[model samples]
Target: MNSNHPPTPRTLPTAAAADVPTFGCVVYISTLPDGRKKGRVANLDGIEHTAGTEREVLQRIVPVFKKRVSECLAAGDSVPWIDPILEIDPQEQKRFLPVHL
Candidate 1:
């Protein structure tokens, strides 16, 4: 992998008054065409599956998230500080994300 594009660590937990971590990451998942779905955990692109069910998609994603979290902890990756993504409407997928890019 290019050093310039390392996988991002998902949102970190909130810090305590002292001796607490101040970094984190975020993961986004959405359904796709023809019973397919996709997502990103940290910077790692997720697997595409044709489960055709929301519960199946969730089942597929759990392991991906867990593995990435382990990697992030081992690497001590810093989560970028930013406003949280508050709105996630599946209907407006194109507008919600930069599909062209």
Candidate 2:
């Protein structure tokens, strides 16, 4: 979903600034506007920014993208980023693929 551009770090959900993960840089998430339950997927690097209408694709992944980041931090990983869920623009939210290197 994302493009060949750098991620603009805007204000986080709470903190003024946080650290983005190491290898878990990019992320792709989706939502089930129809409200149908489904499975989801994320790379080992914790990058999930896209989804399909499959059992594993799981569309309602948007509301939890930040949670996923939190989980990685809970696992004792150095997540050098913050949850910027509040600043996610609906139009810009679609570009979540092709993470930045």
Q: Top model by lDDT, which number?
A: 1
In candidate 1, which residue ranges exceed 4 Å CA deviation?
1-50, 79-83, 90-101
- Each prediction's total of clashing residue pairs, residues at least 3 apart in sequence or on different chains, is 8, 12
Over 1-101, each residue of candidate 1 has an lDDT whose tens digit, in order, gives: 67999798899778755543322334455666765655433333443334566556546655654555456667898423235443445552321121110
Per-residue lDDT tens digits for candidate 2, residues 1-101, read 47988798797587555555433323333455764323323333333434444334433444355565567668988654545532433422223332211
List runs of model 2 lying over 4 Å from the truth: 1-59, 78-101
Cα TM-score per model: 0.39, 0.24
Q: In terms of TM-score, which candidate is strongest?
A: 1
Which 10 residues in a row give candidate 2 its minimum summed lDDT?
92-101
Q: How close is candidate 2 to the true structure, as a TM-score?
A: 0.24
Ten contiguous residues with the weakest lDDT in model 1: 92-101
Cα error, residue 95 of model 2, in Å, equals 4.4
Query: Candidate 2 overall Cα lDDT vs. reference?
Result: 0.43
